[model samples]
Target chain A: MRHDDLCHEVVSNLPTHGDCFVARDATRNDSGAIMDDENKKQINERYEKHLEKGERFWPDTIFRDLIMSLGIFTLLILLATFVGIPAEPKADPSDTSYIPRPEWYFLFLFKFLALYGQLPVIGKIEWLATVLVPSVALGVLTLIPFIERSPRRHYSKRVLPISIMTIMVVGIVLLTLMSEVPTVSEDGSTLLGTLQTVVGIFIPLTAYVLLFVFKNNTRLMLWTTGLAAVSMIFISGTVLTLAPEKKTEETEVATTLVDQIFAGQDLYSVHCTECHGDDGSIAVIEGVEGLEGEKITPIHSRDVLYTITDSAMLEVIAYGRPNAGMPPFGKTYGGELSRSEMDYIVVFMRYMWDDRFEVPQEALKPLFPPLAEGEVPSYNVHILPIVKRYCISCHRPGKDNNNYLMTTYEEILTTGDNAANNIIAGDENSYFLQVIQEQPIMNPENPEEELIGVMPPTRPLKPNVVDAFLRWIMNGMPRTAAETGALSTTPTPEVTPTP
Target chain B: MWKNIYLWLDERIGFNDLNKNLLDRPEPKTTWWNTLGSASLFLFVLQGLTGIFLTVYYTPSPDHAYDSVQYIMEGVAFGWLIRGIHHWGATLMVILVFIHMLRVFYTASFKYPRELTWLIGIGLFLTTLGMGFTGYLLPWNQKAFWATTVGTQIAGTAPYIGEFILKALRGGPDLSALTLQRFFSAHIWMIPAALAGLIGVHLFLIIKHGESHFPTKDD
Candidate 1:
C-alpha cells in the first residue's frame, strides 16, 4: 500500500488500538519503507552486536560527560571572574544616536537581514529576510530527520545534506564575523555591500543550487561546497581588512558607588555649579546669562532632598523648572547630559549632601592626585580634570566665554580671542592665570572694563588647585606625565628657609 | 545506623532498578563530541541556579531594573559571580546545544527510532534562544532595551499576524514596564519550565534508545 493509504488506515484504526505507539509504528512501517522491517531488524542486530562489545554507560560515557561538564564549569567561572559583563548605561528611550545591536549569537541573522535588504526588488519586502527566511531555515532544520529519509548514517553516503549543511554553517559564522562591517560606507559606496552580499547571501545560495544539480556526483558536490565556503571566508576576510576602523565610543560607565558619586560630582560641577553654587547652596543665581539674580530653592537643602524621591529629582533635573528659570539638563529635552549622567548627578547629591545616605570614604578623595612639594603638574594629569570640573561649563563652545574653548588642551591654549595672551608659557601674568586667581584681566584699551572676569565666577578654586595651575604654567605647560616628570624639581632642604 | 537508613530509603527508591535502567545501561562507544548534550544539560542547570539567585534581587520594573542590577553587582555579596555565571552560561548553553544538534545531525543519529528525539531537541534549541531573548531584556540597559525594540520590530514584519506577534511579545504597542515584567516572567518561569519538561523527555528518549553507534561501511 502507498504511504497515504497506510496513514489513512492507521488513523481509521487509531481508536481500536489503545496504544498510540501501535498506530505510529504502523504509519512509520509503510512510510519508512526505505528502512523496511527486514532492514530495521538487521540494524537492530548490528546495534545489539556493537552493544555487546561496548563499554558500560555508567562509567565510560558518564566519565567523559563529567569531565566535559567540569571543564565547562571551570571555564565559566574563569569567564565570570575575569571577564565579567561590561557595564552598559541605563536605557534612554529618547537617545536615538545609540546603534542597537543584538546579542552576539543573533549577529549572523542580523547581518543576513542587512545584506538581504540591499537586494533590489525583494529586499523592499521586509518580511522576506526578517521573518520568512529565518522561519523557512528553522523549519528545514527542524524537519531534517524526516526530510533526509535515506537512512544513510555515514558522511560518505549523505553527501548532499552534509555539504549543504556545511556551507550553511560556514555562511552563518562568516556572516557573524562581518556583522560590524556596514553594507554601505558613509559615502554611499556599495562595494562593501555588494561584497558582503556575495559572502553572506549569494555564494552560499549559488552553492546550494549547484550542490543539488551535482547531487549524483559526490566529488562535484563536495568541491562546490568547499569552493563556496572558502570563497565566502576569503571574501569576508577581504571585506574585514578593507573595512574602516570602527570608532569606539568611550562612554565611561561608573560601576561602583564611589565611581558613580565621583562621576556625578564632576558632571554637577560642570553643569550645575553655574546656577547653583558649588555646594548647591545658592538661593539666588548670579552671573549666569539669562537667570541672573533668579531665586531658587537650594537643591542641597533637607527639604528638597528629603521631599523629592530620586525619580522626582531626576524629572525635575531633566524637565527643569521652566517658570522658575531653570533650564532642562537632560538630553531628552535638548540638553547635554545623558540618562546615566543625570543618574550620576543624583547619586552625587545623595551621597555628598543628603543626610540619609552614608557616603563611601573613597568618594571623598581629592579630584586629582596631590603633588609633592616640587613635583610639576602636567596638563593631562592635573589641568584636564580640573578644567573639566571647574571651567568647561562656560569655557566650552556656544558659551559666553570670549570664544575660548577649554574642551581640549590645544583649544585651551589656542582658541580664545586672547589666545596669544591666555597661557603664555612661564608667564605668571597670562590672562588665564590672572583670571583663575580671582584677578580680573583689565581691558588695556578701557581700564575700567574687565576683559575677563575672575575664572569660575561662582566659586574660587581651592588653594591646592591654584598651586597646581601655578606649577603647570611655570613648568611651561607640559601635556603629559612623562613630560612633567622631566621638569620636576626635587625638594631640596637647602632651598627651604629655617622657620 | 547509616546503613539502616540507606536500606530503608533504597527499599522505597529501588536504587538497583534505577542503576540498571538509568546509569548502568550498555551503549555504543562514544567520543568527546557525544558529551556536548550532557554538557548542555549541565549548563542549563547552572543557569537555572544562578538565575534563581538573580531573581531574588532583580526587580522587573524599568525604573528599578537597572538600579536593581547595579545593586546586585555592588551591594549584594557574590552577586557578581552568580550573575556572571548566568550571563556566560547563557552564551555557552546556546553554543553547546547548537553543536550537539550538529553532531547528532552529522552522525545521522536522529534517524530511525530517534526522530521524535530530534523533534524535541529542536524545540529545546528554539526555547533556549527564547530564554536568551527574554533574559536579555531583564537588565533594561541601553543595549538590552534597543536590541529588544529592534528584535520585536523584526517579529512585527510577518505578513498577516506580525503586528499581533510584536504586540504580544512586547506586551503592548511599545516596550514598556509591562514588556519588562512579561519578559521577566517568561525568562524565569515559562521558558525554563518548558525547557525542563522538554529536557526530561529528551533524556528519557536518549535512555530508551541508548546512544547510537558510529556508522561504518558494512551495510
Candidate 2:
C-alpha cells in the first residue's frame, strides 16, 4: 500500500484539491510515484454497474426444508411410540434368575462382552476394549479434525480421519458379530452352517487391514465403506434370523421351594451365614446393634416370620440387611449372589426352619414378651400375632394386598389405608371384621357355617383362637396386662370348634 | 438471630465472589463444536428445574408411586408438559454430549493440555448417562422397577467389581425403598455435583490454554 506501489493509471486520477495531496503528488516531489487515475476510474465504473443490476441471493419456499425435517422427526416419534417398550409385571424378588441385556443401541457392546467376557482370566480384555478403547477413541476423535492441521475440507484431501472412522465402524461390527456368534456349534450345521456363516468374519477384517494399508486411495476407501455398511446390515440381519426363538414353548415350571431353599443355602454361605448363624436367626433383636454395632435380627423367632410374609422374607434374602453386617445376597443387588443358583436357596430356608435342628429353645415367654403398660394384652399376645399369622399371608407387603394386614401398630390403633371409606376401623361395621367374623373355619355340622376364604387362605387356625381375636376387637378392646392379667394365658372362653 | 447470623455468615467466604470466580471468567475463542457442551449444561438445568417441580407432589412409597406419577401425567396442571420437557431434555442432552465429543474429535481437541479434561468429560458423560439410568427407577412402576433391575444387572456384569457395583447401587440384596432412596440421592447430588466439578475443571483448563488451534496449513 506504499505510494510507489500503486498502478500508473491510479496516480493521474488524483485531482489537485486544496490541502489534500497524495504522496505521489508532483508538488515538492514527495516520492511522486503512484498508480495513474484513468485505469482505476474504469475499474470502479464496471463495479458500479454490476451492483446496479441487482443479483438474486435466495430461492423462494425456504421454509420447505425445515418443515420437511420437522415433519419427518415427528412421524418417526409416532412410529417409535407404536413399537413401544416391553415391560414386565410387578417384580417378584423371589424369582432370581431373570436374564438382562441392554436395548439394541448398546447391543453391539454387549455382544462384545459376551465374546470376550469369559476370556481365560485375561479376557477382561473385552472390558477395556469396549469401555476404555471406545471412550479414548471417541475422545481422540473429538480432537482429531483440529489436530490434523489440514487446511482442506473435502474427503479427497482428509485421508487419515476418513480411514480411521471406517476402521472404527468395521471394528465395532466385527466385535458385535463375534459376540453374537462366539462359536460355530451344532446348530450352525442346521441351516447351511448358519452359525459358521454367522462367524463368517474374515473378509471384512481383511478389508479393514487393506484399508489401513491403502489409506490414501480414495476410490478403495469409498468402495470399502459401502461394502462394510451392507455387510454390517446383512450380518445383523442373520443374527436376528438365527437368534434363539423368543417364545420358548411355555414350560409350566412349578414354582416351588426346592430350588430357592438350596440356592438360599449357598447364598447364605457367602452372605448371611457369618452373621445369622447359617440359619435366619440373629441373636440380637433387629434394629438393635450387636458387638460390632451392626443392627441385626434372628430369623428363627415366630415373631419375625409373622411380622413379614414369604415374599417379604424373599426380599430380605435377596437384598441383605442395611446398617447390619448382613451382606446382600445374589448379584441382583450387586452382592455375592453371583456364585449361587436359585435351586440351592430353597434347601437352605427349609433346613433352617426344620424343628429337629438343635437350636436355643429358651422359655416361650422370652420369645413372646409381655405387653408393656398401655399396650393391649389382646393385641400384643393374641390378636395382632394371629392377624400376622393368618391375614397377612395374602394382605402383607409384596403379596395380594387386597386388605392391608401389614398395617402398622399405628394402623391397628386407628384407621386402615382405605380408612372409613372401606373399613370402619374397630367398628364391627368394618367390612374386613364383618367378613372374618361371620366366615366359618371348616364346619360341616353347622348349616350356617362351612369353609370360607376367611383370611390366610392357607389353613384355618383353631376356632377358639379366632374367637379370642374377634372378642377383643368387638368389645371396647381393653389393654394393659396389669389390668387384665387373668386373661393373659386363658384359653378362649368360647367353645373350641373341631374343624 | 442478628448477632449469631452475622457472625456465622461473616465467617464464610463472600458468596458473590465465589460465584464470580466460577461464572464471570473470560471465554476463549471457542468454535461451533464447543457449543454442544453449553447445550448439555442448558439441558441439565431444564432437568433440575423440572425434577424439583415433579418432586413437589411425588410420593415415593411403592404402593402409591405408580399412582402418583399417573396423577402427575393426567391431573396436575402443566405436569405432563414439564415431564415431557424433562424426558426429552434428557435425550437431547445425550445427543448434545455425543455431538460435542464428535466435534472435539473432528477437531483433535483431545490432544496436549486437553487430555485430562477429555478423560474427565468422558467420565462426566457416563455419569450423566448413569444419572438418567438411575433416576427412572424411582417411580417404582412396572417400567421403572424392571428397567432398573435390568440396568443394575448390566452393572452386575462388570468384571470382578460388578457385584460390588450392583450392591452399592441397589442398597440391599434387592430393589426396595432403600434402592429408590439411594438412587434419588445420587440423581440429585452425587452425579450432578460430579458433573459440576468436572465441568468447572474442564472450562478452567480450556481457559488456561488458548482456544484450540483451528486447522490451518503453515499459518
Candidate 3:
C-alpha cells in the first residue's frame, strides 16, 4: 500500500469522535484491494496493533499549533515592557569627553581582545581573538554537522565536540567579567594570596597545553570552562573588594555644600528639568504658549555651570531674566521667590555647575568697559599673541576642526563653511562681534559661529585682549595694521600663564 | 493535499523511509554531525525572545542609542540580565550556524542533490551576520555608533562600489534617521523572514536526505 494509505490507516486507530471516517474505518476493515477481483485485502495488520506510539512528525503540523508558541513569546515581550530598561539622560554633544563603550554582550569580546593585545610575540595578532577567533569559532561551529555524522547519540563518544563548545562559552563569560570589573591591588601589601602565583599565568598556560594534549577528552573542556569562569569571578570580586570608592565624594554628616545641593534637587527637578533637563544638560525646547523657539542653554555642560559663580547663578535663577527670552521670576518683578528660596535654586545650579566649584558670585560680573568704535586700543601687540596661545590648540588645519581652519590669516578669512557671518561692520551683528559682548544679548546662541566654540572654549577672554580685538573689529576690521597704528609699532611679549 | 505533494517529492527527490534505517551510508549524516542544526535553531528562538524584550526601550536614533543602552544596563530591573542573554545568545547562534555549515562541507553534504539546501543555508548565514552587523550599529552609543561609523567608512572606502554599499547599509552617506529606520526594519522583519524561509527549506531537505546514513567506513 502507498504511504498516504498507511498514514490514513494509522490516523483511524487513534482516539477520535464517531462523526468522521476514522471510527468506521477502524471498527470494520471491509475494503478489499479493490484494484483486482482476484486479490483480497490483508485482514491482519502487524503495525495496527500498537498504534499509540507513532513517529516524531506525525499528524498535520498546522498554523494553529504554532500560534500558541507565538502567543507565549508575545506575552514575554509584553512582560519585558513593564520590566523594561531605564534610559540615561540624552547624549550631550558638547560633552565630547565622555568615553563610549559597547553593549554588555560585546563587552566580553572587547575586553578579551584588550587582554590579548597585552601578550608578546604573537601579540599583534590580537585581532585574531577579537575578529578572527570568533569568526573561526563560528566557522567551525557551522561546519559541525558535517564533521561527525556517524549517528552516535551517546555523550561519551561526543566528548571532543562538547569540549570545543564548552571552551568557547567559558572564554566569552570570563572576558565579560573582566571588562565590567574595577581594578584593585590584591591584599594590603602583605603576603600574596594562596592562589595568586598559579592563578596569573599557570592556568592559561595549562589550558593551552590541554588544547593540544587533551583535545579528545571532556576533562580539558571542563577545566577550561571552570578556569575561565572562576578567574572572571575572582578577578571581578577581588578588584571590587579592594578598589577605592569614589575619592571625590564624602558623606557630609556635618552638612557640606553637596548636601545642600542634594537637598535642593527636588525643587530643581520640578522647575529645572523642563528647560535645563534632567542631567542639567541637553536642553531641548518644546514650543510653549508664550515662548516660540525658546531654548535654554544646556546647564549640565562644563561651560555654563563651570564658568559662572554661585551668587551670579542665584541672581540669574531668581530674576529668571536673560535678555528677552527668560522672564523675571522674583517677587521684585511680580514673580514668586523669597531670598532663601532663591538660594535653594542657586544651590542646585551651583551643584550642577561645578563638581568642585564652591565660590561666590563676584567672578562672573563684567568689570571693564568693552571697546566702542574709533578706539585704537591694541591688536598686533595683544590680539595676535592671544591667537597663537589659545585659539590654535584645537582649531588648526588637518586637525579635528570639522572644517573650521584658523591656522593662518587666510584660513580665518575663508572660514570654510561656518565663519562668523554675524560679525557686521560697525554693528554688533557678526558672530565675532556678539559672543563675550560685555552685554551678550546681541548674538545668537549657536556656538558654531565663534572661533574655538566662542573662542578660548575652556577659559574666559582676558579683559585686555577683549578690548584689543573689539577695537580692531570696530575699526572696519583691519587684517594688517597699515593705516591704523593700534600697537603696530609696539612688540608686546606673548605672556600665557602656564596651567 | 500537501500529503500528495510530499509523496511526489519523496519519489522524485530520492526520499524513502528505508533511507532512515540505512545507517551505514556516508552520503550525508556520517556520525554525530546532525545536532548542530538543532542547536542553532534553539539559539534562534532564544535570541528572538530576548530581542523582543530589548525592543521595549531601545531608541534607534544615532544620538540616543548609546545613552539608552547605558540606561538599560544601569537602570532597568534585570535589564542587564536580559541584554546579557541576548548578547551571548547571538554569539552562540552565529557560532553554531557556522559549525553546521562546516559539518556539511566536511562531509560533502552539499554534493549535487542536497546542494540547493546548502546554498540556501549559506545565504541564511550571511543574512544572519548581516542582521548582527546592522543591529550592532543601532544603539547609537559611542562604540556602537562610532564603530558603525568606522565600519561604514571602511565600506565607503571601497574603490567604486564602496559608497553605494555604505549608503545602502547605513541608509545614507552618514548615520542618521534614515540609517536607523532602515536597520531597525531589517533587524526586526526583513532578515527574519528570509531566515525562516531558509530554515524551512533546510529542514525539508534533511528529512528528504534520510540522515545520509551513519559512518560505517573506518577512520
Candidate 4:
C-alpha cells in the first residue's frame, strides 16, 4: 500500500486518539508505487478496517514493548548471574579427542546431516547434507514471501504454508533433541539410528509431499501435518528412550588463577617432582632409573624461570629436551598429560617459583586437613590427596611400581603385586604402612633382597603424614568421612560448662 | 528555562514530526506476541553493549586470548558479569530473532506491500546467525576452537569452491591465530555492521508500512 494509505489507515483506526498531522504528512510522503491500484486499494481498505478497532501505539503498543524489553533484560541478567558460562580449557589443536559440538541452535542441522548420512547409496555424498541441504533450506526460507504469494492472511486460507512450516519446525526441534543419540551404537545396532532417520528425514519429507498433493483440501492437509508431526515426535521419543546413556567426560577446567595454580602444583608434584624435586630445586636428577645423577638446570632458578617463555616451556614439556634427561609429558608426544594439564604446570611454575608472579594464598593450603590426636583419616579426606601428591607419579599405570596404582582408593587397596599385604586393615606390618615409614618389606623368598623399596624413593613423607597413615590403617581403613568419624577416638574435645 | 530549552531542541530536532510518524501512530490491537520484534531489538542493543565491554579485555590472538579472558574473569571487576551477559545474550538473540520470524511467517505478514520488509527481515536473521558464528571463536577455548574447525570444515564441503571458502573462513588451512583474528574482526565489526544496517532498514520498513494486523476471514 502507498505511504498515504498507511497514514490514512492509522488515522482512521484511532478515532479516540486522533493525530491531526497524520493525513497531511502521509500525503506529503506519497510517491509512485509498483503495485496495481486495485490490489493496493483492497489492501488499504482491509488494513483500514483493522485499524478502526486498533489501539493507539503510544500508550498501548509501546507499553507492551517496554514491558517485554524489561522482562527480557531481567531474564538476561538472571541467566548471566546464575547459569554463567561454563569455563573450557584453552584450545589445543593437537588434542583431537576433544569432541566438537556446535552451538545449541545449530544442533538440529548437525543432527540432520548425521541422519542424512545414514541413507543408502547417497549417504557418502558429504556435500549433500553439509552444503546443498542447508543452502536449499535457506533459499526456500528467503523466498517465502514470493513462493506463497496469495495475500490470504487468515490461517484457513493459508493451510499449505502454515502446515509445511509447522512440520518443518517440528522436525528441526526433534532432530536437535535427538542429536546426542548416536546414529549407530557401539555394538553396531542400527535400531535407534533407523528410528531417528524416520523421525528426522522420512516423515518430514513425505509429509511435505503429501501436503502439496492435498493442498486444495484443508482438512486433509491438516490431518496429514498433524499425523506426521505426532508420529515424528513419537518415533523421536522412542529413539531418545532407547539411546544409550552418554558417558560424561569430566574435563577439569580451572577458571580462577588460584585454581589453575593449584592444579598446576598437583600436576607438578605428580609428574615433575621425581626429577625436579618438590621445589624444582634439584640440580641433579636422582632416583629416576637411567637419568639418576643427570645434571640439569634448577627449574626454579631465575635462569630457567626468566629465560623460558610459557609457550617455549610448553614445547619443552611437550617435546622433551632429548639431549637432557627430560621425558615428554604431553599427550601429543606419547605422554600422560593433556595440553591443559601442561599449561597448568607452567602456570604453577610461574606463580610458585618465578619472582615476577605472586602466588595466591589460597593455593598454598595444606595438602590435607591436619589430623587431631587419635583421630582417624579417611581415604576421601586424607589418603586421596596424599596419594595424588606423593605416590601416583610412579605408582600409576605404565610406571614401574610393580603394578601398584594409587589413583583410586580401590586401586590402592586391591591393586599391586602384593595386594593382599598392601594395606591390611589394623595391621601396622602392612607393606604400604611399612614402606611409607621407611621400612622396606624384605623379600621372603630371597631373604637378602628388599621387595618393595622405601616409598617415593626420592623423598620421605613428612612425619605428620606418616603418623596419619599409621593411625588410619591401624584403625581399619575408612573410605568416607562418616566412616572415619565413627572410628575417631579424640573424645570430642570436652565441652566446658558455661554459666 | 526548561521550556525554552525544550522549545529550542524541538525546533531543531523535529520532535513533533518524530512523534507523529514513529510513536503516535495506530497499531492493530496487539498481543504479547507483537512485542517480540521490540524485544529482539532490545536484545540486540544489549548484546552490542556487552560485546563492546568484552572487547576491552578479550584479546583476539591465540596466544593471549585464553589468558586475557581468564584474567578478565579473575581480576577485573564485574568482568565475568559482562562476558556472561554477552555469551547468553547471543543465544537469546538468536532464539528471539528466529521466533520473531516465525510469528511474522505464521501471520502472513510477509505478503503484499510488506514484502521488502520480509526480505530485510530474512537478511537480519542470517546476519544474526553470522554474528553468532563469528563471536563463538573469540574465547579461543577448546570448544570454540574445535567447533569452528568443524564448522569451517562443513563449509568447505561445497562442490567446487570448498577449499576457497574454507581457507577464506580460517585464513589458512588450520584454525590458528589468523582465524581468531579474522573471526574477532567479523564478530566485533563486520557482521555487526551488517546486522545494524539491516535492522535500521527493517525498522524503517516497519514504520513505513505499519505493523501487520491479525487476520480475519472476511471477503
Candidate 5:
C-alpha cells in the first residue's frame, strides 16, 4: 500500500528519467527511496496543493469516457439510420454539368477558392489558394507549439492567440456558410454585385486590423470594433439580401422558342465552346488537337448546318461522330446532354446557320390545323410526315423513349410506359394523344397521380401537326387517303375498352 | 472464474504488472481539456475498426469502388452505420487531435523533454490528414473525384518534383484505376502502419517523460 511498493516495480523498470519526472516533489525525494505511508501522505498533500486538478485514468476517467463513446456510437448509429449517406449518380466522367462540391468541413477551403478565383493575381496562380496558402496555414498550425513555448495554460494570459483563434473560427464558419453564395449576379454581368461582396469581406477585416492596432485600449477596442463588425456584417447582409439574387440554376420558362434557343446557346458555350470555338466555326480545336489528333468540322458552316436536317443533326449530336473525333453529347449515349438539351443545341445551330429555319416574332403563334370543313386530314400527307419529322428523332431506336418507336404503328400502339398503349385508334384516352395535347401524362396504377412531362420534350409539335395526328387517330387511323372512308364501317376494337 | 483466468495468465505472462503499470501511473493534474488526446486515440481506434469493416465489402478498383460503396450502404446489414462512424470518426479525430495539439501549444507542454513528443505528434497529425485525404477518393463520386483532382494538383504545384509527385500519386497525368489503388493502399495500409509505429514512439515518450503538470502561479 506504500507509494514505492505500489509504483516502484514499474517505476524502476521505466527508463531512468521516468521516475525523476514522476516524483512530483523531485527535489524532496532522493534518487532512490522506499517511501513509507507517512512520506506517501506528505507527497499526496503536496500534490493536492501544487497541482490544479486531475483524476485517475482507469476507473474514473476511462469509465465515463467509455460511456460517452457509447453515447457517440449510438448517435452515429441514429445518424446513419435517419440521415443516410448520399451515394450520388455513378461517376460519369463525361457528365460536364456536375457541380463538384467538397464535404462540409472543406467548404471553408472551397470558399477560399471562390475568393482566390476573383482576385486578379492570385486567380492566375490557383495553387496560391489551392496549395500554397493552405499548405502555409497547415505548416503554421504544425509549427505553433514549437514557436510559442510560453508555459501559460490560462486563456486570459494568451490574448493574441485567443483573439486570432476566435477570429479564425468565426472567419472559417462565415466563409463555409458563404461557400454556396455567389459573388456574381444571375446574368453574370454586374461587377457591382461582386464589388459589394469584396467590400463585405474587407469591412470585418478592416475592423480586425483596427482592433489589432488599438489593442492598448482593450475593453473600448473590443466594444467599438465588435459593434463595427456586427454593424458591417448587418450592412453587408442587407446589401447581399437586397442585391439581385444569383441564379443558381437556370429557370426553365415555358415561353417562346427564342429563349429556348438562347438557353441552348448558353449550354453550347459551356460544353462545346472549348472544341467547337465560340461561333462553332473552329476547324482545329485548340486543346483537343493533341488529345485525338483530328480536326473538328465547323458546325456553323453553311454546308454542314443548312444541308443536314434537324433530326440528322440531333442524331449526330446524340450518337456523336466518334470516327471524326467528336464524343457523344446525349445522356443515352453515355454523354451529358439530355434529349431536350440536344434539341436545344439543334435549335441553336439551325437558328444561327440556316436563315430559313429562323422564326419571325409574328409567326410565333402555335401552328394549329386550319382544317377545311368536312375535308379530313390525310394520314400519309399530314400525320406521317409530322411524326417522321418531330417525334421519331428521340422515339426511334437507341434513344430513350420507353421503346415507343414512332417508326412502326404496332410498336407505337403496343408500347407505352408500362401502363397503357401509346396510340389507340379512335380513342381520346390514348397516351400519345394525352401527351401531345400538353395534358398530364398519367400512370393508371398509382393512387397518387404521377405526371410525366409532355412528349417531344421541351418543344411541343406544331398545333396543326398535333391536330392532324389527332384527327387521323380519332377517325380510326387509315393506311392511306383512300382507307379513310373505311372507318365508318370498321368497328375499332382498339377503342372499345381499356382492358 | 475470470479472476482465476487472470491469475493464470498473470502468473505466466505477468499481465497484471503491465495492467498495474498502465492503470496506476501518476497522472498530471488536469481538467477536461487534457482528455482530447484520449478522445483522439479512441476515435482513431474507432476509425480503424470501421475502416476494417468497410474494406471487407469495399472494392479498390475505380469501376467497382462506387458500386461497392452503394452495395455496402444499401445491401449489407448495418453497413451504413459502420461507414458513417468511420467517416464521421475521421473528421472527429482530425478535430480532437488538433485541439489536443492546441492545448499542448497553449500550455507550452511541448517544451523541454517533450519537444520530440510534439514533433512526433505533428507527424501523427500529418499521417491522420493523409488518411483522410486518401480515404476521401474511395467513394469515387463527383465530389471525391474532383476534390482529389484539386488536392493532388496542389502537390503538382511543387516546383521541381511536382510533376514526379503528381505522376506518382495519380499513376499518370489523370486519375485512374491505378490512382484509386495507390490512394487505397495509402489509406488502409501505408499510413496506418506509419501511424501505429509513430503512436508507439509517442506513447513511449509520454510514459518516459510523464505528462506535463498543470502550470501553477509560481512556475
Candidate 6:
C-alpha cells in the first residue's frame, strides 16, 4: 500500500516478455518505503500490457538518449571552434557617455521596458512591465497543471492551453526580435518620442482583445494574434529603418589632406593658440607672462617661414624652446604629441600662413639645409638638425640610450651601444648605419650574438631621412660648408634638384 | 584483470542489483521529446566542465576581470574553446530545459502522481535561469554590468521590500566589486548546487513513478 509498492504494482501491470524476471523481494526505495509483492500477479499483468508497447530504459532509451547528447556536445564543439567568443574593450567607469545595454538573451525584457517606458501613465508604474507582467506570466505558467486537469493529451483536445502557449511564444519572440532591432533613433528618440504607448501596449492589448473575441474559434484567434503581432513588428521595423540617422561627432573627422589640415588647425588651436594668437602671427606671445622679455618672432611671418625650414620648425617644437619658455610637445621629448601629430602641426602652419609655399606630398629633403643645386649637404646644417629633432631626445647625454650620444660632433662620432666609434665615415658596415637600416651585425668572434634590434628604435626613421644619413656618410662626413665643398669631388653621385 | 576488478567492486556495491533497478526498468515507448531531459543534463555537465577550466584563469575582481578574460581569449591555450562552450552551453541549457518542461506539459506528464516531479522540474527551470543571470555578471564587461544592473532591478520591484531586495542583490545600490563577487559565487556554487539537488529529486521522482506515456486512442 506504500508509494513504492504502488509504483512496482503500476510497473508490473505493464506488459513484458515471458523471460521478464521480476525482482519481487520487498526492498526499500530511496524514500525508505518497503515495496511488497502483494499484487505481484496483478502488477505483472500491467507490466505485460505496457511491455507490449514499451522497452527497457537501458539499451532502448539510454542508447538513443546518449547519442542525442553526443550530438549536442558535438554542436558545442563546432560553435566553439568556428564562431568563437567576443571580448570588448576594458571597462572604464569614468566614461559615462557609454550606452549600456544587456546581453542578447535578455533583449526581450529590455525591449519590453523600452516599449512601456515612455507612456504617460503606465510609464510611471514601469515595474508593471518590468516585474508584474513577467511574474504574472510565470505564475500562470507554473500554475498550469493545477489549472488544467484535462485527462486527454491529443493536440485537438488541448486547444485552449496550447493556443495560449502559442500566443505567448509568439509574443515573446516578437518582443525579442523588436528588442534586437535598432529601435532608438540617432537622436535618441524612441518611436519618435510619442507613439510608445500605442506601439508598445495598445497593439498587444488589441491582439489579446481579438483573442478573447475569437476564443471559441481557437484557430482563428491564434491566426489573428500571430498575424497582428508579426505585422506590428514588421511595420515598426520598416519605419525605423527608413528614418535618417543623425550625424555622430565621429563622422566629422574627414580623411582628405585638406580635412587633415583642418583637423591640424583644430589641434593647433588647443595647443599653440594659447601662446600664439588665433592666427600663428602673434609676435609678442601674450598669455605667458614668463616669456615677456624674450625676443619671440611671429612663426607665420614671411621672414621666419622663409628663414627656418620645416626640420628646424620641428626641432623647436620637439625639444622645447626652453629659454623662450616654449614647452616640448612631441611625445619623444617628454611631451604629448606623436610624430604624426607634429607633422599635423607643421602642415597646419604652412596651410594657414604660408600656403604659397607648396607642401610636398611627403616631407621635403634636408628639411634643415633646403638643399641647393650642387650644394653638397653638410653634417651640421642637415644631419645635426635631423638628429636633434629625431634622435637627440633619447640619444643625448644623461638619457637612456645605451651610452650613445648625438649632442655634439665629438659625441656623435664616439659612443655606440653595440660597438665603439659606431660612425666610421665611408664604411657602409658602420654599426650606426646598420642600426639605422635595421640590419644588425652578428659578432664575428661570438656566433651566439643576440643581434640587437634597429636604432631610433621604436620605429624606423623615414626613408628620405635615412637616405640623407647615407648620403652624408658616403660624402666622408663633411662637417662644415667648406668641408662639404672639399668633399664635393669625392665621387659623390649627381645631386639633382627634386622637381 | 578487468574481471577481477569488476568482481571485487561488484561484491561490495551490488552492481547487478543496481543495474537491474536503475537501467533495466520498463518505461513508456521512447520518442524524440524524451531526449530533451538528457540533453539538458548533458549541457549542464558540459557547462560545469568548461566553467572549471575558465575559473583557472578568471579573476573575480573588477580590476583584472576584463583583462583576465581577454588574456584567456588571446593568451591562454584553448581558453577560448573552453569559455565559448561555457557561454553557449548556458544558453542552450536554458532553452532545452524549457522545451523539456513544455513536452511534459503537452503530454500531461504532470498528471496524477507525477505532480511532484513537474513541480521539481519547475524549480529546476528557475534554478537554470538563476544560473544564467548570475553567470552573466562574472565577465564584468559593459554588457554584463548593465544587464545585471537592469535584471536585478526587476527583483527590486517587489512591493514593500523592493528597495532592500535590490540593494541586497546588487551588494549595494550600484553594481560594484562586491556585485561581481556575489554573482560569481552564486553562479559557480550556490545555484549549481541547488540545481544538482533539484535534478536529483526530479530524477528520483521520475524513477519512483514509472515514465508517463502519451495518451493513446483508447485512453
Look at candidate 4 and tell me the lDDT of residue A100. 90
Per-residue alpha-carbon lDDT of candidate 3 for residues A288-308, written as tens digits (9 for 90 to 100) = 325545666777677877687
**lDDT ranking of the models:** 1, 4, 6, 5, 3, 2
Model 2 lDDT, residue A51, Cα: 33
Worst 10 residues of 1 chain A by lDDT: A15-24
TM-score of every model versus the real structure: 0.91, 0.43, 0.40, 0.91, 0.59, 0.60
Best by DockQ: 1
Q: What are the runs in model 2 whose C-alpha is more than 4 Å off?
A: A1-88, A95-99, A103-105, A115-158, A167-208, A211-226, A237-499, B1-35, B59-67, B109-117, B142-147, B150-162, B201-219
Please identify model 3 stretches exceeding 4 Å from their true place: A1-54, A59-78, A91-95, A121-126, A145-153, A182-208, A215-499, B1-129, B136-174, B181-185, B188-190, B206-219
Q: Chain B alone, TM-score of each model?
A: 0.98, 0.79, 0.78, 0.97, 0.95, 0.96
Categorize the docking of model 6. acceptable
Candidates' lDDT values, in order? 0.88, 0.52, 0.53, 0.85, 0.67, 0.70
Can you tell me which runs of candidate 1 are displaced by over 4 Å?
A1-33, A368-382, A425-429, A437-439, A462-499
Rank ordering of all candidates by DockQ, starting from the highest: 1, 4, 6, 5, 2, 3
Fnat values, one per model, are: 0.77, 0.08, 0.01, 0.79, 0.35, 0.55
| CAPRI quality level assigned to candidate 5 from its DockQ score | acceptable
Comparing 3 with 4 on lDDT, the higher-scoring candidate is 4
Tell me the alpha-carbon RMSD of every candidate.
7.9, 20.3, 23.9, 7.1, 16.9, 18.8
Which CAPRI tier for candidate 3?
incorrect
Instruction: Give the TM-score of candidate 6 (chain A).
Output: 0.42
Task: Report, to 2 decimal places, the DockQ of model 5.
Answer: 0.25
Give candidate 6 misplaced runs (Cα > 4 Å).
A1-51, A182-184, A187-200, A207-499, B1-5, B217-219
Q: How accurately is candidate 4 docked according to DockQ?
A: 0.71
Task: Say which prediction, candidate 1 or candidate 5, comes out ahead on lDDT.
Answer: 1
Q: Which residue window of length 10 is worst by lDDT in model 3 chain A?
A: A38-47
Number of the top-ranking candidate, with lDDT as the measure: 1
Model 5 reproduces a share of the real contacts of 0.35
Q: Per-residue lDDT for B22-58 in model 1, tens only?
A: 9899988889988999999999999988988898999
What TM value does model 1 have? 0.91
On residues A266-348, what C-alpha lDDT tens digit does candidate 5 reach at each position?
Answer: 56755665466556766764423243335767888888976888879878988888877778888768876765566677777
